[model samples]
Target: MLRKHLLYLTSDHLFAYLWQAGSLTPGPVFGADAAGLRAFALWLADGDTAPACLLADLVEEEFQRQLMPHVGGHAGRQMRRRRLHQLYRDTPYRHASVQGRASGGRRDDRVLFCALTSPAIVNPWVAAIERQGVPLEGIYSASLLSGALIRKLALAQPHLLLVTQQAGGLRESYFEAGQLKFSRLLQTAGHDGMAAGIAGETERTRQFLASIRLLERGDLLHTVILAPAAELDALRPL
Candidate 1:
């Protein structure tokens, strides 16, 4: 059995050892859920080191320390709950940086990584984690993360990735699969119903894919939506 449990961190929440149906390691992370934020690296703290629950309490006093008005608000209080046993989902899509670290029985299969969030949060957190010497292999946003998870489930390599935006227009691109495939961040009506949101996102993704064909189109790889279908109709199969 694995002796050391994994830690999954993100902007909103933190979870230790994320999985999907006992399948793969390096599972997807939900940017909106505070519980999915794995802000700290597992190696940063030894297996026995306990997180300071006081940190949550300390946050309320931070505004005063900054010489700003004290908001007297509790921020990041629930991350340190030692007794939360239901933190992990029952899936094999676990995420980790250290290659051999996540090795359960198969020492050959590589772990996948997906990070979905704005640069403001993802960038700084990534740097912070790296500075602290947290090990990792890949990183992507929630939308891409979700998509990547789907691809893993399908046992296919993703060719394209899509991200949703509330406003500020749309953006898209690709990372590992050369320049042919890409990822996109676009403004869609998240608050709007489902069909509209899915249609908008799907349209944007299609445009980007079609445009990429101008340069050189091989075959469509993969497209994913950050929001679940229940929240908003997901843009899949693009």
Candidate 2:
């Protein structure tokens, strides 16, 4: 049986987990420090070379939405690479994806460029993985995973706002016509008054969308909160 590894990375720590036979076993947590990085490398050296998927939930992640001239084949990929480099020159952890095509005359493709702006936080961890010869499947962000979650849940809202509580904090992702348009993270101090906090953040996010013209005046905004059953029960009233 092939065992899979999952790494949840935040600014403060990296949590490792083992997945086998549909069960997940928690592993050691490595803090974001010199000693922690060294320990992580040593741990990897002793563990099996199972392919790992890194999920980063960081405040430094950035996203930009733009419409680019539609092109295809090799040239299109080259163009996107150049654009992504131009957008985030300092970070190697950058990705670009074409969401859809615009409706207007040129019908340009809608591109979303995302990156972890602060390489200082992620480089050490990646370097450790490289030094240990670990096969990293790919690095993903919480916001990116939320899109997958929406698809898995079969959410078909045209204008949707998805809020999720993660170890790092509250992640709010906004989608237009079922495509992710924007996302932001808010770090809460504690679990106290979490429901109120969610309500306040949702309203603020809605206002931000309207200000950016993403949400039209008086248009309906469908908001979905993803959490465990206990958390959902607490949030249901708001």
Candidate 3:
């Protein structure tokens, strides 16, 4: 069967978009409640409950990423996961997992590691989707998907930041050499006007990149921002 529907589930909203032959057709965005979410998703599927890839954009501020020395094969994966587990043992999140991909052009074949502090909120949706007969092809976080976009963009800047507006807040994903290095969710809402609020958050993200050494003093930092046209225009000058 051809899987063409993409569902993006965030903390408060669920959005359905169409995907066909490398193009995306944006659809409706609705609440995350089972009734509404299922209705819209089925509508997008043309009332068929066939399997589709659920590209979940989780808003939980728990995703972490890093670059590490690459080891080859299955053993390498195990080693990386173990290292990530150890790193998060002291954190408040009790459950987590590590996933990695090879960093580009590194002579030593270093890999980029991504650690996710599992969101407990998504558990209910898992059952909801199953009950509704929506076959779940896969669930993914924004950080992971953003990496693919960064690589696809083939940005000239080695270090860059991508900020997208989501239901709960602004989601920021950091890319180094087109590899996902870090991600965070800023819950900045209603404190100020939309434009200023986003601008302040962008500055904070830049500082974060600098503190982590992903950006150096006076180094060119490129940002790819995804927002509505009005707010996007305001961000253009920043």
Count of backbone clashes, every candidate in sequence: 40, 0, 0
TM-scores for the candidates: 0.34, 0.94, 0.72
For residues 31-58, write the lDDT of model 1, one tens digit per residue: 4233323424433444333221100000
Q: Rank the candidates by lDDT, best first.
A: 2, 3, 1
State residue 4's C-alpha deviation in candidate 1, in Å: 5.1
Q: Is candidate 1 or candidate 3 better by TM-score?
A: 3
lDDT of 1: 0.35
Whole-model lDDT, candidate 3? 0.65
lDDT of each: 0.35, 0.88, 0.65
Candidate 3: which pairs clash?
none
> In model 1, what lDDT does residue 50 have?
26
CA error at residue 131 for candidate 1, angstroms: 7.7
Q: Please write out the lDDT profile of model 2 over residues 60-120, one tens digit for every residue.
A: 9888989999998899999999999999999999999999899988999999999999999
Between candidates 1 and 3, which one is better according to lDDT? 3
Query: If ranked by TM-score, best first, what sequence of candidates would result?
Result: 2, 3, 1
Task: State each model's C-alpha RMSD to the native.
Answer: 17.9, 1.5, 5.1
